[model samples]
Target: MSDNFSRPQHTAPLTPILQLVNSAPIVLVAFFAIGLSWWFLLIGVIFLVVGGFGYWASWQRRFFWLNEEGELEARSGILFRRSRQLRISRLQSVDILRPPVARLLGYSSLKIEVAGSGDSRVILSYLSVGKAQELRSEILALAKDERTSTQSAEPADHWKWQVPNGRLVASLVLTTSTYFLIIGAVASVAFALVEPGSGLVTLALAVGGSTISLIAGITSLFNFSVGRNDRGIAISHGLFTTAHYTVSPIRIQAICVVQPIAWRPFGWYQVAINVAGADQSSKKSGPRVLIPVVHEDALPELFHELLPSWNLEIEDEWLASAATSRWRFPWQAARLAVSLTSDLFVVRSGALTRRLSAAPHERIQSIRITQGPWERKLGISSLHADSVPGPVRLRGRGLASSVAVHTALAELDRMFTARKSRKSEQW
Candidate 1:
């Protein structure tokens, strides 16, 4: 019964029917269907009308109002008329989502995440593009103001890692190539088993499938974007439902940078962080946002701006003193080896890109050390690391064979203990 409508920080006008009609896929599908039957055309017309009204209704129900009182109000659900109220202080992270059509319509959706148990959250769709920007700016200002008021000294810049374009290209090529190969292999096998009479049909189907895969890969390029500014990082990506994530440094629990095998050639890597209440995916999924590609050089700057608390020493000068014995190692690696290693250890050092040292630790969920028969004979071993966020094994991608299995266990111990200690301190 609250009749007083508070002032909204921003508002988005509902997208119209003309905007939906402009979509290429919908237009193409509707055109093709109409050509097949008058009945189809009738159904299409009805759909367009009903769908437009529904879009408007959904828009009306999904508006938001952020007042000067440091509170956020979201109105949603057409029939149920549900609304949520929350203090801005409790907000965890604010995510902006824009679908392909939403992009064309120049609008985005907003999700206000808060720290609480169960399904306590607020989401508003159809926020005008301008309003989304304003809201982001406002939130950043408020968060900064609050922090500045509380503390006199600011944290130093430490973490500086962003996805590189080269890595993105490499990832795209690898993904597309694998998909095409898989499709071709499967189609060839199927055709070989089929009768000769349908040879032409099978060939056509194969070509069509390959073309779709190529298109999908091309579409993925739009998913590429950037993350910047002081409030935190904002990543924009997706083919259908374009996702935008805005994370603040205060909420970050851990930040991890990973380089997978496929991207090793291009020196491409991914950066993700374990954040508090921000990892929206299931418990099995990795941390919040995945910057699928990034240059190694930029990581230092990005880290400094985003996570000042890490105090990461990423310079080659510092690395020089860390030591390498046919294998590179960090100060933490020595501790890992001491605590985790049962007997043998593996230490691998790279002149440029990768350096690893691993050891076994107590109460390990899974520990694996792998080596080829040649390595086995030579008494060399490779160490593997795994946890709830998934495994990170440094064995492959060109490390030496002389590294013993014992080295790996120690490295594992070092890595886990450091992380656990850091986590405990944060608490």
Candidate 2:
């Protein structure tokens, strides 16, 4: 706690580049809206104003290290100047990000993420690209130096890094699906070529629009990296501009491995850490994404490194195949017989991966049993189990009817609620 070790001196602190990068969206917005109305010019002016203020703020911010004290500090802000200090002992993970423009300029950004240390988020925006690896090694050395002085057993300094294999493919999929700039460019050009008025203006807009999209795509692909080091997990991503996220072990709330249909063929899954301090505005954007997209086999290593308490075996406990109900089967059959007399009815478990699962009583968030008029006449039901992200529904179809659905919901509720009231015990 004394902060006695010698730290490196600041060497021409990196200029803030992320601020410039955040301004790109505003410019793209202006270009795409060129011929809409006078509002387009107004929007451009608004972007200029915001970008100018951001540039001023960037100039005001500076991050550096103190040689004698072995501490890192960053001071920044236009309206509210803020500074954060960190000792080497509390070091967590260090990450590097380079947008295409940053790479072109031979510069890379460094984020020194620390845990146990309060509010010491350091972002160095314009470090020499050539020095990135060397600087990373130097920082780790400083961290090791602190550990040696403590006389306690030093933690292993090795970091587990997960780099995505299909990052470019994923980027393309996202761009083609969500990005509107390409369509905007085409529209702008087509109108410029064929329309009567403002041909030159439309042409300029189309060219500008295309350039931004290409730059954005290149920047996005070059900037994604996830790693778990001494302190915690670090996520750094972006193309022209980048954001750095550091989450401490003690602060982690939940960890979920997500698999989408698109990634199924490659056996790829994404690991997300739900922590209290994370910005959860977007599903893709996180306080950090530890591993962007990697093979399922690699999950164990990543989870063990980042979340020591996590058990991948818990996947076995998720519901897959439905259970057979003796009493309900007859009821369901009778209902299905009557309902299907008019129309066909189907029932099955929602999980694609078949497995045995006993739903934990305490974990249940909500339970509902629904019946439409047709199903009501047949005495059948549909059951839903809701959670934070969404609901998992199990339809009993016609075989068991309402009795089976109600029984399952009641059993699940009892298990979840009872567990909540009991003392700590092994799962």
Candidate 1, residues 1-427, lDDT tens digits: the string is 1222355432455554434554436646777866658776776677777777776676655656766576677766778886777666766666676766677868776666666766556766557777665665565455555555442222222333433445455576665455666576676667767754455565666667766775665455445565554445555565666656555544444334555455666665555544445444564212344455666776566556554455433222211111232233333333222112232122333433333332223223355666666544544455454322322232321223333344444456655575455442121
Alpha-carbon local distance difference test for all models: 0.51, 0.51
- Runs in model 2 deviating more than 4 A are 1-63, 67-70, 74-94, 97-100, 112-122, 130-253, 275-288, 295-309, 314-427
Ten consecutive residues with minimal summed lDDT in candidate 1?
A: 314-323
Candidate 2 CA-lDDT value: 0.51
Show where candidate 1 strays beyond 4 Å. Answer: 1-5, 8-11, 16-38, 57-63, 67-69, 143-167, 175-228, 238-242, 249-266, 272-276, 279-291, 294-427
Residue-wise C-alpha lDDT for candidate 2, range 355-393, written one tens digit per residue: 111123344345566666765555555554332331122
TM-score of 1: 0.58
Superposed Cα deviation of residue 261, candidate 2 (Å): 3.3
